[model samples]
Target: MSEPESENGAVHEAQWREVRYEYTPRLADILAHLRATIVVTTYQAGKLLVLGVHDGKLQISFLSFEQPMGVAVGSDRIAIGTRRQIHFLRAAHETAPHVEPHGMYDGCFVPRTSFYTGAIHGHDLAFGRDGLWVVNTLFSCLCTLHEAYSFVPRWRPRFVSQLIDEDRCHLNGLAMQDGRPKFVTVMAEADEAGGWRPNKATTGCVLDVDTNEVVVRGLCMPHSPRLRGDDLWVLNSGYGSIGKVDRAAGRYESVETMPGYTRGLAFAGQFAFVGISKIRETSVFGGVPIAEDRANLRCGIGVVDLVSGQTVAVFQFLSGVEEIFAVDVIPGMLCPLIAGASVDKQERDVWIVPQPGSGE
Candidate 1:
């Protein structure tokens, strides 16, 4: 796919068949300035988009995945939660120069391993000190991957009476602090199967993972709880607002509101990158604040100035994609490529072997 030059420095258009997008010109500049690349997952479209800057232009690489949701980025690897498995890809910087359109990309991610999780409806993921943590939504608990079983249950809220695939509560979003799981966000504190749906709009909350206590409540389908230093930030998803939790007072303070339903969130330097999606008029998304202006909602990422509480730039999808689940930033990587798990020749033919005389 090719991108047209910025139209009067306002919009940069990129199109490939039905997948069309237009982004603010400054979006490319920000990525270039930070030397970072963005990875977005759209389960609705079955795609994982790697967006970066290449030779003064914005470049996007689309990779196929089945119902890709959560994304966890480590120093040299990335973990992606999909339909029934979690895929792990390791960065192979040595192969970067040899990728097609040589030398344009600085990072090449190759499939390293995968773990079958059996469609537990995993949401957010994080690499904690102990191991890879997954918010196993269907089971209403946090779990880790294990070779002998689908998943090893780590922790579940006290209110959950049993470990079952009932989705008693939509337990999603995890925040790790100092290498350990610290806080989590849940759609509701309900204890019965599908119990959260009735009052999901006003029953959302944040929980202190360590104490298993509800620290903040009365949220509107809150997601993406992130701890930046001492501040606990989250997306009041159903309401289309980004806010911070006042743990002591059990409240959430809105920082800024956007036009779309916010879900995925990431932080880099002084800005926050949030994934926004247009909600479908389904029973699950019917009565939310953002739904009031559903027609004006967008599907893409928004760049927010954390300090000034302003949305600085936006990259919007015009067609072929909707409902983004996760957003992650690959730091220090300007342009990157991912070899997806596909049967295509490009993925099958690629091989990585140690250099001559190097230890294997």
Candidate 2:
């Protein structure tokens, strides 16, 4: 795409171009007609693992990405965590699925003496008949996680599945198997141990929802794993590849990745929408308050061609520059959920969640 202005004080237009690999914006008039909704937000912001409209409310969860990238999820009754301390809450309306409070951790990771995992950072989560399954990446040494280091509060999470050893990679994404207790994680790299950080696993692994076990191993930083119409799709966050694995053969390939930092992912019908966060060093700033950085740098959404591995459409965030943290496309529901913070950090917004999967 090219931006050309008129020499005289007149009107100028933008346009897009079609190339072999990328779709360049044309220099002419562009259409502007798109909208999205906010799901929810927490005071502590960083890496994310879950976001979607479940039951009758929009649910959002987060976990650190790098060190002891532990996760934090708050249900109406109380919040659960794998941080530095062990904690829990007894609530009256805790039975409610929504209303999960933030900031408070039911438990935290204590190192050395309490080292099963100081903190269990994660990406995807699934709740089935068996129980709640959380897939996460840990420092290779974490395999030695002890009972005392269980920071998941009273829940005593099954703490299932992890990446392979040797290669340090972050298992950033996860998805459930339609009706079974099966789950999948994506390895961003085709072949690597882990990210820059050590003690991480690189190989991809499969998790048994029934048993918290690192079933498979050896994969890159697979960000998001999804089961779409029987086909498994993995957003290899690091490789910028959307791949699929043939369960029978156990083979996968690098499909495609949108241009930029690809974090969370979801599906609405046949369309695959990805949460694209604007690169900080790549931003113009434009005097926009650092608080608004998320919004200001927030580019729109992009649609991926699952088969062709290409981004067909992009929903930009130039309007207000929202730094999209995570996205979940709910086809069964009317509207999808986009969980993130406004640039200014003054307030946290839960724009969507009108009526639990309601596209309101």
Candidate 3:
């Protein structure tokens, strides 16, 4: 709740970067009601933000990372994909009450391990039956991490002739079903370097990972395909809409369109939490419907009522954040704290050890 202040009462530049934001009063209420915490990564700001409710107020904890992109949350672990490494953190519930402001947080994620994946531009991640599944955008394939090598290739679009760092198809979203990678969303089926950039607005499609077949086509730069129950949901990013893929009809059914470009998506009960970002006004973002009104674009998380397809609450950034890469809901955790990788000495001091009389 406190920000660094200077002599004139303005935020200080030398201290930690100031993050200004606003949210509907109900946003905190909704999170508290569900007993959940929202985690979002903003590569543009190199931050992983944890949003929760503390005493009927919005509490935000910012952790530093190097261009953090993909985030995967499980029952007891959280995985974060950065520029050149993937960090794994395990929740140490035993020590949650000791986290300063003692008892304010109900969960504490302590960094436990990391794997160097080079600069593969890894995207969406999910824990599956086989372990961690990553959308390796640079190599145009789905891969898993290993201790001996950077990554082990699992699946790729048949159109991609070889594994290379060209970002050929811009394969960025992965949806896992029944503990396995089921579907993915890509900008295009292009097989050449940067080939998906030109027609990104119209060539985006979703592919079945098992069959390597395009399930739906002609999307508007789609990202974050997810399976909620029996429905296949995806973000039509360029058009700023959240929709579902009608597999039988081979088309996308728009559910709700937000005010900004949408990318990240997560589901909690009957609600969908979506990440919204402003258009960059570059050729990369041109020719998109949402880009037409850049002045009204917003950067925040929109809580959508899936049953009604209407946004019920919003959390907006007034400054210091422009884009969001991933969003995930941490269920049953009202407030949580994440120790950033090497950001402060506190992480070094915190330790996780077995309880007395526990087996070694």
Candidate 1 per-residue lDDT, tens place, 1-360, comes to: 112234222222223337777777888888999889999999987778888998878887777778899999998899999999999998798898987778887888888899999989999999988779999999999998889999999899999999999999899899999988899889898899998999888999899989999998899999999999899999999988998988878889999887888999999888899998999879998678888898888888889988899888888887777788999999998998787765343233347899998977
Lowest summed lDDT window (length 10), candidate 1: 1-10
Taking the tens digit of each residue's C-alpha lDDT, what string does model 3 give over 189-226?
99999999998899999999899899999998999999
**By lDDT, who's the top model here?**
3
Each prediction's whole-model lDDT (CA): 0.86, 0.38, 0.88
Give the lowest summed-lDDT range of ten residues in model 2.
Answer: 26-35
Between the candidate structures 1 and 3, which one is better when assessed by lDDT?
3
Q: List per-candidate RMSD values in Å.
A: 3.6, 13.7, 4.1
lDDT of 2 by residue, 1-360 (tens): 011222111111112211111112310111111222222111123322232333323232333222222222223211222343222222222223232343222222111112233345533444433443444444322121225544232111133223344324344455656534355453423234444233123444544335545544444444556778777766554333466666666566656645544555666544566655554543232222222434333343466655556666554433223344445532222122222221123223332223577676
